[model samples]
Target: MAGVRKGGDLEEVEIDLGDASDPEDLDEGEQPETLWKASSDREGESIHSSSLVDISDTKPLINVRDPRGMNDCLKVTFEDVIAEPVSVRSGDRVWIWSHALFEVSRIWVYRIVTVLLAIPMSILSGILFAVLSCIHIWMISPCIKCILIGTRWLQKLWDVVLEVIVRPLLTSAGRCCGGFNIHLAEE
Candidate 1:
């Protein structure tokens, strides 16, 4: 069972590949039967078989060329992007050929552009990141550390000045004014 999305709607397609595992069960020169049945989700629609491709050979139906899965951006093909609902299908071979041309041109253009730009852009990015890292680690970080150490020393000096000079002066002033009293008499 495979789900194919056509124009933002997912339509279910049932694929019948009879007896894939036991090839010896069939007699010589007998090929496995492959059936593609379209089961649409729309109401009152009948199931129909469309021969999309011949997959009688032992090769995989979908060949993934990207072994490392790097080029995920290029995974969108003609079938993925272009599709017609059952009602609006034009049944024109020219449209199909145009679609094939569009897909091939898109893929080739992207590959060529990437081949031209990927290496240079990657090198530039690597150099930029390396420079930024060096500036942060060697220059900015050490400067900040030095400023913090100087700030700690200045804080200790400020605390000592407050305790020694300010506190003594305030205490002496308070002691001198301690005995002063005012009395009011009315005749």
Candidate 2:
């Protein structure tokens, strides 16, 4: 039993699990009965009872056996590919035959294609990735690092040249030009 407050009023909810304390005590195909009851704080209010759903009574529409999830991409069925509204469904026998044919043909075609191409493509892709990784790690990365080190030395030399030579020359030029003045006239 649990108490819940709703809109300033306290409501009580009760869960009843009948008879069996341990789930293992129930026989195969037997489900423990579960009931939910809700009652308000107001006097003379009736308790509302609701029954819990039994999961064993329901079954999945599609049963896919993909242990490693490898066949997830191929789990589409005839019903998934084709569907009609409930009011416009095809005849029962025709739909059943179509489902059987589609599933059988799809499975066989996938097996045949994989047998022909899977191994060769996997080997080719593996070799290609290995070569690309080696080139990037051994050749391109080292070359880029060498270039970066050389640029750092060149940058220091450039800064020294700018400060020692260019700065003095620009300062002398500015001093020489400081004394000269030109007048602008309109003709």
Candidate 3:
């Protein structure tokens, strides 16, 4: 039993699971014994029962193998067991049949994704690539080439300036300090 407060009123909900009833039977006016009942705090008020989501008739998203029930394991036989054609069950409770179902689902997903998402994504990528290529060809490439040429010319000018100005200044300073060698042995 779980209780919740709604608008200052306490409501109690009890889950009935003794009958193990299928949820699909609720729509046919045969309410399953296993249900959730909600009672309000007010007296003489009837219990409110909301139908649980019924998924018994629908196929499950995942494959589950029943160990004790039918289709438990694969049987290896030397002779034919049944002459009648096997009916494919909607829900794959069998482990071996699950592989085929998975492959079928994969194929559908691939087709849908290719149709819905992949085509649009590819078109967007193509448009972006074309725009970038146009920018690179018209604007970016010329700017890059001009920057490279300017950088090379500036480097050459810097080397020439350093040789003309700094080397002569250092040589003149050495001469003015009364020669390049000041030996302790001579002193």
Candidate 4:
């Protein structure tokens, strides 16, 4: 109790690491209780804000040669707040575990796109059917019937061959090969 105080608050935590001349010289009273300790008031205190008191008359953040180290952490920021950010769903749908499966506009736009693409494609198909019928035909009546049946048969054969040979090796091998062996490829 020669230099120890009873009521005065601890203004600074003095770390005398280099003062230990011998390992046996460290008595029970001389050793600190904790291995690593820091004042809680250093929270959010910028290193540039505090200045030196001796030369500059302020508590400056100096890069000491003895304790040469620095620690930094990752900081994620959105808009203005400094904390965890929330991801907003931009669609009207049921979001399940960060994934929205029942998208309203997704299916709607898909249907709309299919209809849009189908309109032009179906019109072209119809025109192609008419033009093919007109080819290699002298008689109008019989030729029209033949063209209709021929076109239908050709389309069926093409669909079969495409599904069996082309599609099995290309787009949908699983579905194409599944019903192909039983001669049930939508004749």
lDDT of 1 by residue, 106-162 (tens): 989989999999999999999999999999999999999999887997889999999
For each candidate in turn, give its C-alpha RMSD to the true structure in angstroms. 19.0, 17.5, 30.4, 31.6
- Candidate 3, residue 111: lDDT: 87
> Among these predicted structures, which one has the highest lDDT?
1
Backbone-clash count (model 1): 0
Which regions in candidate 4 have their CA more than 4 angstroms from the true location? 1-106, 136-187
The C-alpha lDDT values of all candidates are 0.75, 0.74, 0.64, 0.52
What is candidate 4's local distance difference test score? 0.52
**What are the runs in model 1 whose C-alpha is more than 4 Å off?**
1-74, 147-187
Model 3 TM: 0.34
How far does residue 105 in candidate 4 sit from its true spot (Å)? Answer: 4.8
Clashing residue pairs in candidate 3 are: none
As a whole number from 0 to 100, the lDDT of residue 81 in candidate 2 is: 99
Residues 40-87, candidate 2: write the lDDT tens digits. Answer: 656645444343433322223234345568867866878789888988
Give lDDT tens digits, candidate 3, residues 1-187.
3444456666566576555466764667675653445556466454443445333332243335454568645452322331234574444355346555666776788788889998889999999999999999999999999998879978898899889998899889888886556657754
Cα lDDT of model 4 by residue, 58-169, tens digit: 2244534234344223221222332233575433343342233334455677789988898899899999988877763546778788888879978899899988899757
- Residue 7 Cα positional deviation in candidate 4, in Å, after optimal superposition: 94
What TM-score does structure 1 among the candidates reach?
0.38
